[model samples]
Target chain A: MTGGTAARGPLDGLVERVRRDPGAIGALFPAVGRTVGRGPGPSGDPDGILGPTVQDEARAALVSALAAALGDGAPDRLAEEVEALYRFGDAEEKRAVLRSLPVLPDGDAASRLTAGLLADALRGNDPRLIAAALGTPAAAALDDHAWRHGVLKCLFSDVPLDAVHGLGDRADAELGRMAAGYAAEREAAGRSVPDDARRLLSLTHGETEA
Target chain B: MRIFDPHVHMTSRTTDDYRRMYDAGVRALVEPAFWLGQPRTNPGSFHDYFDGLIGWERFRASRFGIRHHCAIALNPKEANDPRCAEVLRTLPRYLAKDGVVAVGEVGFDAMTADEEKAFAHQLSLAAEHGLPVLVHTPHRDKAAGTRRTLELVAASGIPPERVLVDHLNETTVDMVDDSGCTLGFSIYPDTKMEPERMVRILQRRGLDRVVVNSAADWGHSDPLATARTGEAMLRSGFTRDDVDRVLWRNPVEFFARSGRLLLQELAPYSGGAFAGNSILRAQHAEPDA
Candidate 1:
């Protein structure tokens, strides 16, 4: 077990159990939900209508367990389960699935399978989900044009620049040109561009200069 | 609605955040010494961070017309690091400074033995200095951590009223509430508590001894969370006086026990540089005549 999974306590054991018995996915939901709901306060709702942070953490653990449990199947079957989870899950569950894309079984192939979901998330305005999608390991699978659009979408929706993964490393001349164009448009419209845009532009400029 | 954010980290925020917070009626705030996103290798890094909190950050906030005070401590997360144990000895001098308000962000993170020791030691520091404390409850096991925090504070002989157990939610507020310690809620964009949820908490618990803060840091958070909460309260039929008590006066009264909260009236920041040098560039600009 890695250090990160070891820290999650019972969820780690449950993951192993589910790996042996795939039918345990049914039992996994209530267990994870109960864990999420166990912390203090009014506890009548076992489904755990908790804060986003706690929910996100719990959901991420559950998704990891699911992905690991399904790892024995063929790559296509694993992808199907992941897609089903993303499609059938609630907002928090969907976010967890989206975030787990990078760690899912087939690496780049698995990430590519979720292209529709990623594109949809980019088009949507839920910053939390958008950030999760953008920061995921799967985001590296995006083509340059889609990646540039994702960057611009973050700016347009007021999401923090920190949400974008590998921002400094990913900067390129095309991104810089796009940022310059965005800056000029903002100026022409008697508006100011975001500080992050300037930062992105500067990083891209540095890379180009190098 | 002059808000006093009893616990926030301005070190991670930009000057634009300060200006926006000031415009949203944040006249004063306390930047509690907490863990930066990354761990520091030694005690010297902590000293430098503490100095920045009390020195350059204060100066920077003043330029935006906000009063900045700080709470110094060895954060709970760092307490486990043997290298950071030296910080416990150096906290006193910083605690005695003029703008130092309380000892805080100093409770349980992982609830480890070292964290307990650091927490107890800091509580004693608060008692010795006659300062208030801002306790950060562990996010993972908050109810148990909060219970342990109250017990430790009680064992240390620090009065419950002198401590503010922060990062509370619906589950933990009753414990802090019944304990007679001040309650702190950190309103965030997606985590912690939301504006409507906070308003509901206030409605259920009443507004006495409660303080709201943005607790904005190097994460996905909102600097305007306090202001947004105030707006939510008004829209939910809370009186203006109730908003004052929760958002402003509660924090003022809580930290006032330190005898270091100097609530001065600062002039609104007109567009100009700090000592004739703007953040944009280093060259001094002539005063407009």
Candidate 2:
């Protein structure tokens, strides 16, 4: 099971296991963090593993089990539960909840109900929460103003721009202006500007002033 | 320069913060449970948080060679909510857990009757659990809150020495010192008590029952505030032993009442997973073309 090629299968098995024992789903969700180890596995053998951690996969499986348990009849309640889990959860649990948002069974209704959470996360200084909030379908819930600030927060927290979902499609002239202003402030403060600032500035496609 | 931060929320912090803390000579710390920025509506929610404090958080800190211990309580703000009342019943189980050095952060948030009730109740819980108590004074109306807090401690029949009244400023310091309880000052970068202010207080009051900490949490705070205070003490002509006494021994003495401090040197954490969770992100090298 420690072999890299078997990584995807175990994750699938976990989902099926939870689905089969719906009675045990409640116990299993929280246990996912403990049961499936988050260590390096052979899955990303060519160079290295670049995607979600094993714990991430486990959390997603648990959320899927939850969605399956509800069986599309209670999308509103599912959204409510997920939001409560996020709000009351620790940073790790909150991050997991945010990561699983786009995959919620009824995508639109669940997204609408929990959209406010993204903004709350954006306002915090935690890089993990900020990065998770900008991951799309979650990012889609934010309007232009909130989205730009979320990207700015990523830069401020040193969260890589690549963590952001759909950065290419969403980066606009105002975002470029904000990035440029941030760059200027960094320069004035005698701090080195981050590479993401340069990337966001370029995304403006000359719409922003020099 | 070994330090014991008596009140930092390591659960909200990152691994980089831990590495930095270790570098700054922070060898041990206590994380008292407090409000998580948002309100908790259910009692069951507190269980998971408490579990994390005793379980995963302790493991995470061990990985960085910092001894992590926690205090379990229904924080003062949460006491006002009836939904959280049930947590009081479940706290004893957590209080009994190893690595739980104290029963804390249990004091006035709004100075409401509900707050007072929980404060008084947890005081007895601390006595019952044979653990030291960490008390949080209300941020607003702190002097009065400190007065009432001392009053409640006096009423609870717990020894004054075993109770730590935290977040004290200039106005409330003399009173807490007079109360025979341990004085806990949370030094911050901007607000609350500054490191210089902390130095003056130590110089005047002497470090008999004083324990200084960073008390860094979710708000705008610095985890190195405790170390910074130690530096300020040295700059003010205090000796090295004085810094160690206040920064390390003071906290150890206060929480040592629990008989549960994990001060023993831990084997360096080699990225081992705790309960299957590594608390680190996935990383795989790129394939050579």
Candidate 3:
């Protein structure tokens, strides 16, 4: 559906339903796991399955299409749809909402309204939520300190840093310092520092290309 | 040293913790449905939480090569909330699901009339479903709460052997022991019960009809407390077989009463990209569906 996978029949069917009645997102969002699929691949990606599995992409695409359909006239409706799906939805549903945040109408207002949701996900131990929270443009709502802590969370939880959006641009000296401290703690505890943390340190030192 | 942590909240834990738990020899666990540290205003949230306990959390544990199981109930603290009472109606549906080893953590939090009412109701649900009950005694008023818990367990007409009275200490353990129900002790990092105290209790109590858990949740607790208690038993001159009896066999025998414990090895999560970030990678461009 996104860029050439098999069977767009179900995805196209969902898109038609949402376009006909945007309100259908509430029901359609949760059913994405069943309609789209978890994708076919080996799960052993070291980056951790804090995913937008290929199927998740299909679901997000459907959400984006709905947002574009609602357009400027119904930002509130879009917001309401996102909120309901996130609040009542499971981890997969929540991830889908987080994935579609950037594509929702009115980016600035959407970002502000969902900042608390982003913060809530960041505060949790679930690597899936943490990665989804930071992986989207919605994460821009997070301030410098919380953003740095999110990176630290990825390090602590072994979520690959590449999952974090805007890491190249946002990887500041403070984040580098935090990573160094975390590395020191891991070393002191006789634990190996994650390669991602070490890579983050190199970026801050301007010794390595992002 | 393969461990079956009878009670834990893996929903609040991380994959790293799962990996560590696996490394420490924990191959299976029963994550009881409990309060989320924040009160829910709607019964729907509990449904989602329960779904995660059975669906996603189960899969997550499988990814770590550990078999995960759960206990379904309206926990004691939340039973007082009339808003949460609606969830009790749905408890039967989940209790009938696979991997639901018991109806649990259901005894008392404040020993309130509301807590007692919900506790008694869930005990009946466990009885109806032929599932075991996991009773959590109040952290405060430990002795009185446990006594009332046993009295209600007796009143429910469910066999005492079908119940697990959790979170007992020196003061409460003897009574739960005498009640003929399985005794559950949660070994914490600092407070409640520590490794040495747990060892002393095992020494005095001898390990029959006993189970030890990390009871680790969103609090300062160890996921490896069961393994630590096993190590403590070894240092105290208990044989490995004795440690195995208490740490592994005892809890297995208790929860397996549900005939639902999945002990077979599952391949760790090897599939890439979960229900997670791949779509967010696209630059704000709405894909044409």
Candidate 4:
């Protein structure tokens, strides 16, 4: 949940299920194990179109997998619980979760936590998620995220021409056109965007796409 | 969590500025004495401005448990005022005083000869005190000016690790990195680097020796700029380690190099003795959480 990569092993997958799913959510130290075959089930859509029960089922699956892995022998169960909540529980629970992650550091743990948080940060301009990711991710994970595709290509890659990735080309030559439209809309309402933004000089305009 | 902004100015901000920053996660900010939007008059105004950075503003931040730190300097923008420049001779004395961290936000604003001259003097002071220098570059013709600033830093013989090239834009980061100094990018709202753009740039440059700042002063800036950059980096699919390097370890290392205060388990503090103090009473308090 804190900004760091958290490797969710098959064992961890089971524990996540036990914690959240009433089916497994309330298990009293249930014995679980990883078959080592399947990857994580779908995270399920974040939009909440999935009903509450379905969400709980998915959570239970995650909890079950988690319990099977670590076996609850580890101390600091509260911290682990908080980290899970911070990562998967809800938006508001992150801050409380982050305050605890800094105290515990294990191998590949921070990075695993970081990957999920970084994904969250990349999704929006949220501060809490940013702080957690900033505080927790493993060094290598941080390096990977910091120097991502387009940027990585421009700064470190041997070929500057092929650095672009992720950003889709929904519309080519659309920036200038859309910028003009935006400018026109603003003028109609007697408003203004900064000159650079109005002129399509925004950094987002890049090589292509609106 | 407690935060010390390490850079900001409140003279040009409104009450809303304080409120929003407080809410957005800024617990403390360091205001380096610098040039205002325009020129200034007698020492009294300058005194008040410095006062705000260390006095009024300090109180304001502490109200939110944000400890305020001040870096007194003759902003490069005002270096042209020979009468004001005369004050430079006295700045070092203040630089040696309490709450002063690495004679800065002093650097080339217009990249004017006067700015260069002032920068040299400040650098000398930083070296003299074993303090790190926080260098602010100009906003226009930035790449050239950043290069120039680096050239002069080497010319002045200031150690690269002891300098933080601030206000960096995408065009200028290379110059900053090449200088072997730490980079400080300001994610100003609507004015400077946008959050998304910052993520893009970070992706290109590693977080090993760089930091992100809001530089939110009189303009429309977000005090939570660093955090915003963190978020954008994640959306860009970066992992957690990347965000931590840039926001936490990097800045912590920079401040340690600044030869300022040492902090451990520090959190935000919004109250205490941030008012008119006995000059003799000035003492570094351990950072609190």
Candidate 5:
């Protein structure tokens, strides 16, 4: 596919493939192994470049295709598929499914259904998974309280502030207050506050400190 | 064993990294202009960054006896920001500077329309300025991004031989090789290709027009990765001549096209102070008179 077309239509061809033979989704697993484990030799892996590993790229492509194909279907049905993928998949696979949450049709319903997964991811120590959950378009669907907690979670976990999308737009008095409280607690314990936390707090007050 | 780490972000690195790199036989290096982790607000920020790359950063590297060169361009990730578009107008002046060698770290990130426009414009700038181009392929969607990069280079009318496409892995190597552009592999830690894997690639592909770099940036990366790769090559039964070809000769050949590459050994710093003043504020205290 041309670069122009690929950016414009990320799931265009993949949706048809998933719809035509949903059973073929299982094939992505082995393809992931073939592409990820060893070199593709001189021919090169056609499925490569979604990420560092073939597994990551394949999983991301498959999840995105499945989400798009099943967008208009019954909400519960789509949730079940996502749940199965999350449960049966590895850490990278789970990350792919979480990242696909935003691109799925019916953004509101998808965000609602995946809130638990996002919450679970935020509670984890894996920076990439947390980054995936926060960076997604679905992350925009987070309610004020959830979003505030997500920001705090990132600070407490040492994830970079850049991982949080629309940070400047979303900064508010409440987040600022929370960040100050976090900073004070770190100070009381004789620890330095994260640089991003300071940046986040500055953003709440509309100051360009960084 | 003298090496030229053709692509690295020494701005994000520490002076100790410079010391280690110098000790590892890295006599010269190039720090490409790249995203500074945070989104810069305007074109003025880019001008300041370019100035540092040419001025302060060069002096700092000279302290460690490493000749510092830099490539000036709007990085691909930031090209999409309209606020920074004015940088294109500001690039020609910096591109002509002494330590500047190429118009680089330029290519697709998200493959946005704005990115393509900036990339094409910079390629033209490289041709007009009589310099080589350093292209960074997207970390995500790398294959299609690389194909598009080559297509754009072909369209830009800059000969493929004058471009060095960096951050390539095993999957994208063949495409870059077939295109006749110089191949650049960033042997970074976890995210990019590893040293052992890089050795295997060199073993298979042979070190013709290939350059290996560390690309050590602000993130969790090792500045000594190029030296580590050289060590790996030797461990794998490759000759020191093979290591030298990939690490030094290939990069020298690529950047020499610009007529700006200075391969001469620079004199090491004679005085302990930088610019006639030491960072230490006071002399050692005399004990009780």
Candidate 6:
């Protein structure tokens, strides 16, 4: 204990990583990082310690997966892995796996995985996961069926602004920007923009009107 | 490691408080002009706040070798007071001066007609002077206020990319990212967003254009919250590169766009704390050198 306490450097991850093989964090996964008054969460597990460690692993795993997927001949083998990742892995594992899809060249496996993750997170009722899912900004990089679904799902999210952008609190700002674009497009296309939304958008053009 | 708190309001604090923060890992900070504890009596207090944000506070922070920068502006809350208009009038002079990175902490508050009026007017003025905006988010019912803030931004048509929305949280992240402007999260003790949560947000969205700030000002806040968040990011599997990117590089790149003075180009303040050195002045024709 004394040695571990005195020990420091980039290897701090390894110490926590050793704790991961036990499936302790994975077992208590969904409850990690939740607050009491916010709402329901994965019941009574105090995941503070495990939460950070698990997230770190998830990120490292994603980074690894992305690097791997970006490599050549990744298709034939990677295809099988993507399919299985969704069916088996839980949220953190699944998310890390999905994040890998971003750098993977658009193809059969990438398409299916992207669509699935986006649809699940954005369309589902889970706000926390959606917030977590968006940590991967691949939505900006995509244009395929999966990307389209993800973007649309953000618009429909229960906590639309809260869950979607998840970065720099620019979601509402982007929602306004996107809504305006849609309105302009509607105008050129000779369609009417939704009345209430347009009114709100008009008022929110830049900064909140008092 | 030594950490620099680039944004704070030490004017609301005492010198002893400064010593405490210094020991607590804050080596520097940026104190932007804000609405005083009570309403500003007049332009003089605003001037004093501006001066302190840039001068006395800078000197005070320097006593600890904690570099300080200032963002001069008429805070939104005080804008409704007709008596406070002169402060906004002084923007032109400060916008071009040193340590003034952006016309900031300037977006919206209250969602009041007067608030919006001041928001739009200041925004326009910032654009006219070609200064970047250090935006402020409303404290109450934030998501709604955040939406309204974005709406005005869209209407203004200032390149959304140049705006830095502050005090972001889970509720407002989606809105900020979608807006395509840079985002700043003030990781304070109780209010604003927390560091652990900020790391999660950072994890979901790779740090391309996001920044984490202490937003530590003259209230109950921390000067090294950014560094703490940085530490959290590291624990969360982000590399040193990622931590530095969110904590320093991204913000440095954004604030550098201010066109006032590149923070990187400024000469390093080399003397010891409280040394007799005055602030950097112009080197004239064959001086004592």
| CAPRI tier for the interface of model 4 | incorrect
Residue pairs with backbone atoms closer than 3 Å in model 2 (clashes): A4-A42, A34-B275, A47-B285, A47-B286, A47-B287, A48-B284, A48-B285, A49-B284
Q: What lDDT would each prediction earn against the true structure? A: 0.76, 0.79, 0.79, 0.54, 0.75, 0.58
**Tens-place lDDT digits, model 3, residues A1-210:** 233242578888888888888888878877775776555212323222444665557777778878877888777677777777778877766766776777766655576557857765664557777888898777888888668777877876557887899888888997787677656645533457778978989988888664
Residue range A1-210, candidate 6, lDDT tens digits: 111111232224433442443223233323322310111222221221111133434433433443353355566445555545544555554544444455556676666666555544443334344544554555553333333234333333332432333323333454455456545534533345555345437445654533
> Which of candidates 1 and 4 is the stronger one according to lDDT?
1
Query: Which sequence of candidate numbers ranks them by TM-score, best first?
Result: 5, 2, 1, 3, 4, 6
What is candidate 3's TM-score against the reference?
A: 0.57
Error of 3 at B49 (Å): 0.1
Off by over 4 Å in 4: A1-210, B1-4, B14-23, B262-289
Residue pairs with backbone overlap in model 5: none
True contacts kept of each: 0.00, 0.00, 0.00, 0.00, 0.00, 0.00
Lowest lDDT sum, 10 consecutive residues, model 3 chain B, at B277-286
Error of 2 at B20 (Å): 0.4
User: lDDT-based ranking, best first?
Assistant: 3, 2, 1, 5, 6, 4
What is candidate 2's lDDT per residue for B53-110, written digit by digit as tens?
9989999999889999999999987786677778999998899999999998999865
How close is chain B to the truth by TM-score, in each candidate?
A: 0.95, 0.96, 0.93, 0.84, 0.94, 0.85
Interface root-mean-square deviation, candidate 6: 18.1
Instruction: Compose the digit string of candidate 4's lDDT tens values, residues B1-289.
Output: 2344666776666556666666655554567677664355346667667766655675665554455667777777677555467776666666765556667888865455777898888778778877778888764345556788898889888889888888776556776787799888777764466778777777787677877777876555666776677778878888877776676667767766656653432244333553443222334443441
Candidate 1 ranges with C-alpha deviation above 4 Å: A1-210, B270-289
All DockQ scores? 0.02, 0.02, 0.02, 0.01, 0.02, 0.01
Over 4 Å off, model 2: A1-210, B280-289
Question: How many clashes in candidate 5?
Answer: 0
Local accuracy of candidate 5 as per-residue lDDT tens digits, B1-289? 7889999999998877888888899999999999876456589999989988997788888877888999999988678667687889989999888989999989986566778999999999999999999999975446677999999998988888899999988768999999999999998765577888888888898889999999999878988999999999999999999899989989989988888877678765433554444322254222321
Number of backbone collisions per candidate, in order?
A: 2, 8, 11, 72, 0, 42
